[model samples]
Target: MKVVLAYSGGLDTTVLLTWLQEKYNAEVICYCSNVGQEEELDGLEEKALKHGAVKCYVDDVQDEFAAEYIYPMMQANAIYEGTYLLGTSIARPLIAKRMIDIANAEGAEAICHGATGKGNDQVRFELTAYALKPDIKVIAPWRMPEDFPFEGRMDMVKYLEERGVPTTVSAAKPYSMDRNMLHISFEGGILEDPWNEPDEDMWCMTKPLSQAADEAEYVEISFEKGIPVAVNGEKLGAAALLKKLNALGCEHAVGRIDIVENRFTGMKDRGVYETPGGTILQAAHRALESICMDREVMHLRDSFIPKYAELVYNGFWFAPEREMLQAAIVQSQETVTGDVRVKLYKGGVHVCGRKSPYSLYSPELVSFDEAGGYDQSDATGFIKLNALRLRVLATMKKES
Candidate 1:
């Protein structure tokens, strides 16, 4: 048999790379998708080749990920469980889709991933694969009930050493990390305890809140129809703009979240995320939308946000409802063009200023000293008319 595997050049994937070849007597083709992980990806092909992959295909889909996946979620404000931005969740389908395409291109009979049965990724990867190609075979070795044994991380490590495969992580500090342009997610190992504060040394992207400068830094972000267009009046493409903001926000220790979230597989999991640029962008976008979006329509759209967030978190990026909800979300953003200035200091974001061509804020009407409408007497009748229901309820209570 010939197989295509989603290989990350990590310990689990490296072990699986050799295991799949041995078990099925198969030719393995590796596929890697880069969704803004800034680490060196140059040596991945060589690593896969060393572990017996027949061929490796690597694609830098960061732009597509940001434009197609991240932006749509951002427009919807799809925060899963009211916190997570679905950083790791949103990237899976794109990777799985490309893996399927490569499988077809290479004439591979089966596609495999290294996601364990205990995690949400297995569902995300398999669901997308099956939805995209119903006839395609999935090889989930982790879910196998048969005799082959490797119960723990240490077991896997020993197995890799026995085979002479290069492994980076060991038993001592065994946290698994996944990174993309949106954020970096930390899981497993010592992070198992929900009460434990993540060590400051573990954070790779953002500065510590304490180490960050005491003075606040202000940034102005511009949005066009809910999509961030420019920063500080500088025009940049989608990828460049986000990268620029990530740099600035990381310097200020802007986005650091440590939460214990319920996984799709019916267990609570701890994930620490650092989403510097996304934090600033989400906050600024919200301040802009406050004036731009209509009251009731925005309320109705907000109701579906949790469900939309769940779909992205659970890995249904290509599902029809996500597309449908996204259509409504994009429609709500029709008038969502504006500029917002935010102050970042230590770990907090403060909205310092906001403006737009379509702003509903009227200085003349709102100014305490203006008295522009000259309607002091009109409020008496308006107040009485609005109070009619309350008066009746009060009279009924008094009589009773």
Candidate 2:
């Protein structure tokens, strides 16, 4: 038998690598998708091979992740539950897509993942896998109680050590983290409790607020049709632009969110997220839309924000409804081209200025002093017409 596993070189995946080989007597192929987890990918293939994998494939999908996934989400202003930026939620489908490709190429009968039974990742992975390739079989070892009865991380570490599988992870770590170019997410361990504050040491991407620069920093982000095209006049690719913003925002201690979010599994999960670049992009994109987008069009798109965010959060990237929503979102971005200047200070982003050539805002039409193009007398009739229903309701109340 043959199988392809999504290997992360973490304790759970490393142990699963050896366990699959022993239990199923199967040849295992390890695949790691590089979606901007900078230093974490170091010696990953070597580690996977040493842990009993027949082969290891590390593919770089950072550019595709930024352009294909991140950009479109930004265009739609996707924010789940009015808080989460959907950093980890958005990365799963791309990883699963690549895993399916690897499975097909290797002619493997089943694909495996290290996602625990309780988390949202398992559903995200399987949903994408089945959506792309319906016949593909998914193996989630954590869900099987009898075959894999390990209680926790310590047990998994002990199993790996007993099997002589080398790992650098320590069981004493207080939390689990997932990192990529867009953001760094911290969960599990001490973060499981809602009341406990995240340790300062757990932050990787942004500086602590106390250590940040005292003076505010100004940054001008340029967007072309809702896509971030340049930072401070220097043009860059999607991934490079995000990395640049990440560095700038990190310096000012920007984009740190701690919230207790509702998971798809019907559990509340507390997470600490540092999304430096993503935060800046969200602010800049919205600022640009304020000028570029028409009022009614913006409101209509705003009406779909929650639904769009929910779809992405629930792992429906390839669903027909999501695609339909995405089509409309992209169409809404046709005029979203401009530059927005923002001030970053003490972990907050303030929109200072915004200008767009496609701006629907007319200074002449809105200036009160000049009467502009709007007639004040016309508003009397307009107000009377709008108040007709309210007036009728008031009369009925008086009669009663």
Candidate 3:
């Protein structure tokens, strides 16, 4: 049998590579997707080959990931559970799709993942795998009924050490981390206790508030049809633009959140995330929409924010309903072209100024000094007409 495994060079996956080969007597082909998990990919392919992988593929999909997956989710301003940016949720589908593609190209019969049974990623990976290729076999060791030997990180570490395999994980710091271009998520270990605060040293992207820059920094972002095209007046590709914003946001301590969220499996999990670029993008995008988007249209799109966010969070990125919502959301961004200036200071992203060629804001009409149109007395009739239903209800109560 031939198998394609999603290899991350992490503890679970490193052990999984050897186990799959031993247990199933299969030829394991390792594939790693480079979605901006910087420095983590160093010597990844060599490590996989040194183990039991018959072959290894390290594909750079960062630009495609930013333009295709991350940008579309931003169009909906999707926020899961009203706080999380859905950073980790949004990256799974793309990774899974690429895995399936590799499997087909390599003539593999099965694709495997390191996602555990208790987490949301297992569902995300399998759903996308089945959705793309219904007949494709999936092997999840953690979900197997007592077939996998290792119980936790410590056990996995011991197994690797006994076999003379070097691993990054240790008994002292056993928490897991998942990183992509959008964000980095940290969970497990001490984070399992909702009351425990994450160690300051564990943070990889953003600076702590106290250690952040003393002076506030202002940044201007240009948007074309709701997609960011430039930062500080310089044009860039989707990936470059996001990277630029991430640097700025990090300098000012922009995005970091810790929450106990309800997972799709009906269990609550605690997760900590750092999303520097995405945080700035969300604020700037809303600011541009404020002027360019119509009140009614914006309201209608806003109504779908929660649902759209929920769909993405629950790993329905390829579902018909999500695509349907995306169509409407994308249509609403027709005139969402503008520049928004934001002030970043001590973890706060605040929109300070916004301008758009399609702006509906009429300064003269809103001026306190003068009425843009000669219609001061027209308000009386408009107000009374709107109050007709309330007046009728009051009269009916008085008569009763």
TM-score of each: 0.92, 0.97, 0.95
Q: After superposition, how far is residue 129 of candidate 2 from its true place, in Å?
A: 0.3
Off by over 4 Å in 2: none
Question: Residue-wise lDDT of candidate 2 within 43-75, one digit each (tens)?
Answer: 889888877898999999888999999999989
lDDT of each candidate versus the true structure: 0.88, 0.91, 0.90
Q: Model 3 — which ten-residue stretch has the worst lDDT?
A: 169-178
Off by over 4 Å in 3: 161-169, 172-174
Backbone collisions counted per model:
0, 0, 0
* Better structure of 1 and 3 per TM-score: 3
lDDT string, candidate 1, 324-368, tens digits: 998999999999998999998887889999998877767877788
Best-to-worst ranking by TM-score: 2, 3, 1
Off by over 4 Å in 1: 145-148, 157-174, 371-400
Estimate the Cα RMSD of every predicted model relative to the unseen true structure.
2.3, 1.3, 1.7
* Top model number, TM-score: 2
Local lDDT at 64 for model 1: 86
Cα-based RMSD of candidate 1:
2.3
